[model samples]
Target chain A: MLGAATTPAEARAAFRGGAVRPTAGIAAGYVQCNLLSLPAADAFDFLLFAQRNPKPCPIIEVLEAGQLESEVMPGGDIRRDVPAYRVFRDGELVDEVADVSEVWRDDLVSFLIGCSFTFESALLDAGVPVAHIDQGRNVPMYRTNVPTRPAGRFSGPLVVSMRPMPAAQVADAVRITSRYPSVHGAPVHVGDPAAIGIEDISRPDFGEAVEIAEGEIPVFWGCGVTPQAAVMASKPEFAVSHAPGHMLITDLKDSDFQVP
Target chain B: MLGAATTPAEARAAFRGGAVRPTAGIAAGYVQCNLLSLPAADAFDFLLFAQRNPKPCPIIEVLEAGQLESEVMPGGDIRRDVPAYRVFRDGELVDEVADVSEVWRDDLVSFLIGCSFTFESALLDAGVPVAHIDQGRNVPMYRTNVPTRPAGRFSGPLVVSMRPMPAAQVADAVRITSRYPSVHGAPVHVGDPAAIGIEDISRPDFGEAVEIAEGEIPVFWGCGVTPQAAVMASKPEFAVSHAPGHMLITDLKDSDFQVP
Candidate 1:
């Protein structure tokens, strides 16, 4: 749910005003993040988990107990800021809701994780064509053999998103994305999927698969959805995440995260 | 105490044989790290602290409790690999020794942290002159107003190392170092040092001060010594660290850590 507005506050207001939809392609220059809210008791462990596995869970901001608004993203409310949210209880999908205000707890901690959407914009600006966006579909994702470091009870195989591009552009794509470490920066796997235990590239465990043209190499990046998978596997008492494709928009400009 | 050895294994062997000297310029191209060995009781918390504050404590490898050698760095023994060791009891420096084998306990966990020396070499190779290296002295460091994200009992002010370079080379220096996140990627602050709470650039809180020319700007990088400072402040019952400049050399090459 978005308008011609360029500010994060405006986007949040639109979402709060019954505009329930995915957040893709909204507020082009700003950052869109993945949301993860968990109990305070589990906060430290989860934060450590994210830290140990930064490529999968690059934290942008962490909200303290009972704090719904982020100090980093001022005036942004977590309760109703995201367009859509998925609630999980004991690791099972309980319901998809527009707002989580009813079940909000004072002891809950919220984490804003970097999404690939920021770097995807960078790739596009650098003349690197993204296949999924061109085909009007979700980027292909797969469960790889790569194991994530276990922190407390959180541990699972890494999840990666795949994009196919020419060998020459791969280097340029890497250079552009590496500047934004807050997002999943650089490719995790560059060539064959079989090397990482992916049997067929066409059939993905998650998201729609895109065609890999001749002379194109399949490149993979650590996915933002990895923490959600970890939470599901850990089976925490309660967890909430932005629904797939739906994201929380923040006031931070993409350029603010650039290294130089 | 170094001899005509050209390999990391040889360097470790020399150190193990009672070498108590600075590791600067030795074992060129191999990765050298700052060591932090603490009791198992504080292992998780210390790791969390490092994860929460990666800019200062970029973890290269973590050895489990009671483990000395690392799979990541083969044939290297932690107990006597470093040129020198400093023992701290209740936050007080009790002793500095060439080897810690006698005091080594089964409950101790080792953390290998990225040192700024790695990136400094990268900067110099990129033709960005390092002021401290040119003068044959330690890089100046200062306690800053920037606060680190506290985890468990570990927290303190950020300590940054300074290098004076012309304004034109700042961008290139940032780009080159940013690719090596394992080595305190990029400059944390540039231009005004007073903004970060540095009272005097001439007299540093740690290390030797170098002359900052009129056209040059003082660039600050997150230092590896930050964890030692935090550990000292936290007053842990038992802790160990490599003597200043007496780093632990690993088999990893500097190019191995580049993001692309």
Candidate 2:
């Protein structure tokens, strides 16, 4: 198991060796990014979509067509670095694999987006408790009735992850998280599941749910899963993405994204 | 004669009527943008270029291929709303016109980039003196030896505008302007001009040079003109850009882009 002292290169090496696992706590202070690779034809559309909806799809870096290495993650082969990769065809899940070097195409343009792990660390650091980490479970996420500003063929409903906290600490969470706009900054909604189209607090559309303790209100934030949801709903001809919780560990420090 | 009471729509209306004038100080407190329109084939390349060099080319909004109306500035036509437009063919200035409606192409994609005018207003509001405004001359801009991160067919030297301020207020200017990253946020260099490769401070490559009074130092911030310079150097088949100092006034207020 990799811990706080693990470097990003070491983490990538471990993943390249077939370690299929979530990459949340590994290389603690460094940034982890959600990956989405698409054909050159669909690259512009996805880029526009992400640009129009920056809250949920904050782009860290975009690798040009046929480019494999990233400026932020130098000497890294994107095809085999992430622990897991999800292959999608016409928007349907075709296969899940540990490496995609054989299937990778020359015209594929990969985009690395900011993940919630960076901001989640800031929350925990600020004395604001995260329910999922405390309960040893995946974060609860929901799809809302809100429609994102669509670009080209990419369009979908807004997705959010919820963290239940004491009503008193909700503002602190908002203040701390808002400092990092690159990683789904600030909460979208603070209370009432129905307000954002969630039917039940106990059941989530994705990930495991934790109890909202007495006197705690549910705080909703824009989720990184939004781009993946768009891929499923819009059904692009081909796409490659990291499995949930499996991310490309980048060299940028968390403080590198913090705003004064 | 537009001033503090002017609305963006009215300012644009004046331009649409063949007022070929610079847009500085026209729509006070509202966001003004540098416009760059390119053929759809080159859109991705320039987008990548701007993404890589955000300090010089901070994008505010991107209009899809052949689309003109902006989300931030509704009821405004891209071709007719700007005070002046520059037509470029194979990297050469072919014409300067008041309206581009006749030459507009169905496949052209327009990019609205953040302008320093937004932050310049913030500096004034914060009690920092602007020498160019007081002298009634343009902010002096220079092309430096600093190379921007190249992307596709777009690449050029970083361009910066100089604003000389009292040494005591330099920190205040930096603190106030850094809040607006969308408008070329933060100074790229502080004191010595020779450190950044500028040979003579009085002779600027672009814009009129202003005198740096005693006890004042020239501070440099990334200029929005860098993208236009790239367009000139790369020699693409076709391109359209706003005339320098002639900008598109948008509906977004200056404070709309202010960070906490």
lDDT of each: 0.85, 0.91
Interface RMSD of each: 3.9, 1.0
Task: Give every collision pair in model 2.
Answer: none
Best by lDDT: 2
Tell me what TM-score chain A of model 2 achieves.
0.98
Residue B156 of candidate 2: its Cα lDDT?
84
Query: What's the TM-score of chain B for every model shown?
Result: 0.96, 0.97
The C-alpha local distance difference test score for the whole of candidate 1 amounts to 0.85
Q: With candidate 2 superimposed using the best TM-score fit, by how many Å does residue A111's alpha carbon deviate from the native?
A: 0.4
For every model in order, what is the number of clashing pairs?
0, 0
The TM-score values for the models, in the order shown, are 0.83, 0.98
TM-score of chain A of each: 0.96, 0.98
Interface RMSD of 2: 1.0
